[model samples]
Target chain A: MLIMKNINKIFQTADIQTHALRDFCLQVNEGDFVSVTGPSGSGKTTFLNIAGLLETFSNGEFLLDGEDVGKLNDNGRSRMRNEKIGFIFQGFNLIPDLNLYDNVDVPLRYRGFNAKERKFRIEQNLERVGLASRMKHLPSQLSGGQQQRVAIARALATDPRFLLADEPTGNLDSEMAQSVMSLLEDINQQGTTIIMVTHDAQLAQRAKRTIQVKDGKVSELENISRQHNQAIA
Target chain B: MLETGLILRALARNKIGALLIALQIALTMTIMVNAIFMIQDRQQQMQRKSGLDEKNSFYLTNTVFGQDYNIQAHLQTDLHTIRNTPGVVDAIQINAIPLSSSGWSMALQHEPGEDKDAVGTAIYMVDDHAINSMGLTLVAGANFQPEDVELRKEGQSTWPAKTIITQAFAENLYPDNWQSAVGKTVYISQTQPIQIIGIVAALQAPWNGWNGVERSMLVPFQRESKGSYYFIRTEAGRRDELMPIIEKTLAESDKKRIIRRVTTIEDTRERSYRQHNATNKILTTVVITLTLITGFGIVGLAIFSINRRTKQIGTRRALGATKGQIMRYFMMENFIISTFGIIIGCFGAVALNMWLVNTFNLSPISFQLVAFGVITLFIVGQLAVLYPARKAAMIAPATATRTI
Candidate 1:
């Protein structure tokens, strides 16, 4: 569960100040698969960053699982992010130098899991993403869809309460994107909360709920059942 | 263990960079070890005791400019006037002063008929007052008596028969039993045999550059000539006060002879070791400069690596790595490289020392100095990698999710 009240994010330069996000408010209950859609520079990623504890909001009252995120320092934020939030970036972002197993092992390592526990979690998650047979292969050796699956496995290795994904299928083909979307839906049905940011309306329609961002503000919120039917029509 | 694996994997991606840095570290360690050894040896040589009363003794070289002056009379008058001076403890005329770098040397043989093979030794021609004036300790036998003193004129054909040798020289002549050398006869040449009447505990020769510095002897003879030396010892803490006075007295005794140089024994010893000290200073400077350059090179490489891997670092950060973890990752990478270099440098250092030993006869490198070089490089590697690592740690995770 997460909540944000009147969040404001400002980017300052030498002679200009830009508002990345202003007066933004949103709430998602546990197990919700929410997709955020926005045009370029509409502050959708900024909202996701603040929600995931990766970036600080200049002015906000943000809460995740009933804890005030605004009061945590850098280290506390990192701990919160590690213990509760998993991230799937658009680029996959798997460390190229590390093999698939090591890529999935990253979050578990930061969580201070013992070797046995880390191995079990890494294998289980990689298997869940259908990549356990290729644990020794590096990210560069895999296709874009396979790399994304590895990234998902890496995010799930920590067993976080929520997943923050920014354009998770941005680089894949339609078939690969559909498979990744289905996998995310399956993960959501298993009770892991997921918030995805995407520009593709069809992909955004696959979520349980969809939020539209514009001019650094949320403009619309709708259940995706009707939107999904409308998108296919 | 996982961190190490990560470091190794990352380094494997940039093999050339890692190897370059490691080779730099190895070269630095090699130069550092050998230079430090040379400096330490030179410092030890400078600190060695010269085995003379350096604090209260001075030597003056007199060169007579006039041809008609009586050199022997002037020498006696100068010695008498110097002895009668207020602070003068004793004064004697000799052919050479200790540590003056101007002295007589000849080869000594164990038997009279031995040819082509002899132990080279410095010969000091001094009067009966030489032992007392130079504060030499007579460890065995007796000092030269007044009647034993032989005055050699300009046209003398034979050398002195009775001589006193140092303990070190005695050991060189008779290595089996040096104490037996006190009354033994040692031939200066094929037929010129001299009797060793006494043995002193220690006496260093004027030329300390060679390994035979400790092998020296004193002959009972008065050297009076235009180019002779006068060694004077004053009471404790009175040498500096008596130097100008001695020079004035000698000048007043005979105007025909000019004092070529007036200096303390301590000053002469310092002058003798000046080249050694200069070499030590130069080696120290080289070590420091090389260390700094090596450190900066590591920093530059780390910075370049970090810049190239910014996205990977950001990904790790987003995966929940703390800033400390990120910094430690970079530092661990540098540590691995430094360790590899140190391991190779150990062999390189020994090889360099072996070359030096075979080429110049230098002492072998010590294990302690090798350990010191390793530790120094380790510390410098870490320090050099620190700034770039901190920068890597500070990268925002949002950078990873950026579309580019």
Candidate 2:
């Protein structure tokens, strides 16, 4: 559902220019689950931002749902991001002032949904993430896994076309991380494309496709199902 | 529509900041209320009535020759010459003008019946022609005749003089009946009991209305008319034309005796009002300065508030709040603050007005108009907050998501 061709990103400081992404290229079809694995400062987050229309690339062509993103202004980009992309951060990034129901209702409000419609969508998403009973609870009141579930529910509440998760389980314990990974798999099974950036190789192996990024460029693009037998061996 | 719950939660997160905003708005309302009061005071001063029809009248002081010489002949000649001048309506000489800052007076008293007792009252000396020249309307009795006060030479008979009583003087001793006091007897001294022939209304120049004493009496200025001034009434739009003629008439006779300070009634009125205008201008400057300070204060506070609540604002923005929504949020806060301030300010204004009325005997304050002024102050507070709210609305989601 998302495509990039020869994307280049550069960051400038007062006395130095840094190339964050050089000739970066990627492609993901509809309902594809992709995980981008890389070490620190490997331009993985920059690539994800470009794909999500959160940041612009210096030189590149990006096609989101077959619409050229380079021609859009900031407002247009924001609208597209709101409508088509959902973000999941490792830290959960929930508004502390709001409870889970309102937290999930936030993005849905931006989509111009009516109150009744937003309520229905939020309830369904919360139930799907197994937090329907705790929808009124605050993020601080929930456990780490429960908070992550609420974050996932918020992301899914807008019914976005794709999900961009940066280290989705980085802050969670092993048990919570595995539960969150399984939750991602179940979400992918329902045909929502997810591009995750994770350093855990075991978690990366669960995705349908794995792309390894190094030194601001993609080094490998491997098909996970084709290597499943080798992993089982 | 934005979720009201979110706005409340956002504001509740920073109670102190919200209170700060309210406090600033309240202060602005207070300053604006007083500023409006000062403006109203200025407008009232402008509309105050001057007791005489001074528009067509002009006054001139003769400084010709020397101060000690008798000016009766010179004054008569000047009066006749002024009457002959084109556009000259009427001219007369009087020992003292109404509402003049400095004048000579003798104590007078009123008696109940057979007694000749009276209290001290201001006495003015005027020629018979002064009644017509000054356009003084008599409330009762007849005008003084010229033959009554006309001066006689050596070995000539004394003129029979009539007295004019002012309304204020008539009010005293007579109580509520001003007309009945006309026929009553009053004496300038215990011996000289002048029969009151007529009663005239009190007259004031612009500034003299504030003086506590209002009683004035008119008598004849005969041989004793020393250091007197001339009052001339010109045709409805002709004072400028008549001025040159009077100047020439004075210059031809005693060239040293120039007519100093020849001014129309409007000039005097403007001079009287100038003090109030200057005060109003200073007040206006102060109001403007205060408004700017208030505006800057609100801007600074709003920016700080939005910054401190950056995440909350971002959450609101991410929740689909338009820039207009954020603007209304802050404006509502300011509105509440202004409303509270205005309520307090109204009470303050009342207390202040009471103090002023008691201490300085100032006029009473109008609570209705003050309420309107306070409402206007609320509008000003909103304007002050609009800029900061817009900046808050434009905060980036990326910045909000990042750790503080």
True contacts kept of each: 0.69, 0.21
RMSD for each model, in Å, please? 2.2, 6.0
- Grade the docking of candidate 2: acceptable
lDDT of each residue in B338-373, candidate 2, tens digit only: 565567666676676677668866677776667776
Query: CAPRI verdict on model 1?
Result: medium
Q: What is the C-alpha DockQ of each candidate? A: 0.64, 0.24
Candidate 2 stretches with Cα past 4 Å from truth are: A10-19, A58-60, A71-73, A96-102, A117-150, A171-191, A200-202, A225-233, B2-5, B49-57, B61-78, B85-87, B94-225, B235-267, B309-379, B400-404
Question: What would the per-residue lDDT of candidate 1 be over residues B136-184, giving only the tens digit for each residue?
Answer: 8898887889888888887565678889989998888888988898888
- Top-scoring candidate (lDDT): 1
Model 1 residue B377 lDDT score: 97
- Pairs clashing in candidate 2? A1-A29, B64-B257, B108-B119, B108-B120, B109-B118, B109-B119, B110-B118
Interface alpha-carbon RMSD, every candidate: 1.8, 3.3
- Measured with C-alpha atoms, the lDDT of residue B143 in candidate 2 is 76
Task: Give the alpha-carbon lDDT of every model.
Answer: 0.87, 0.73
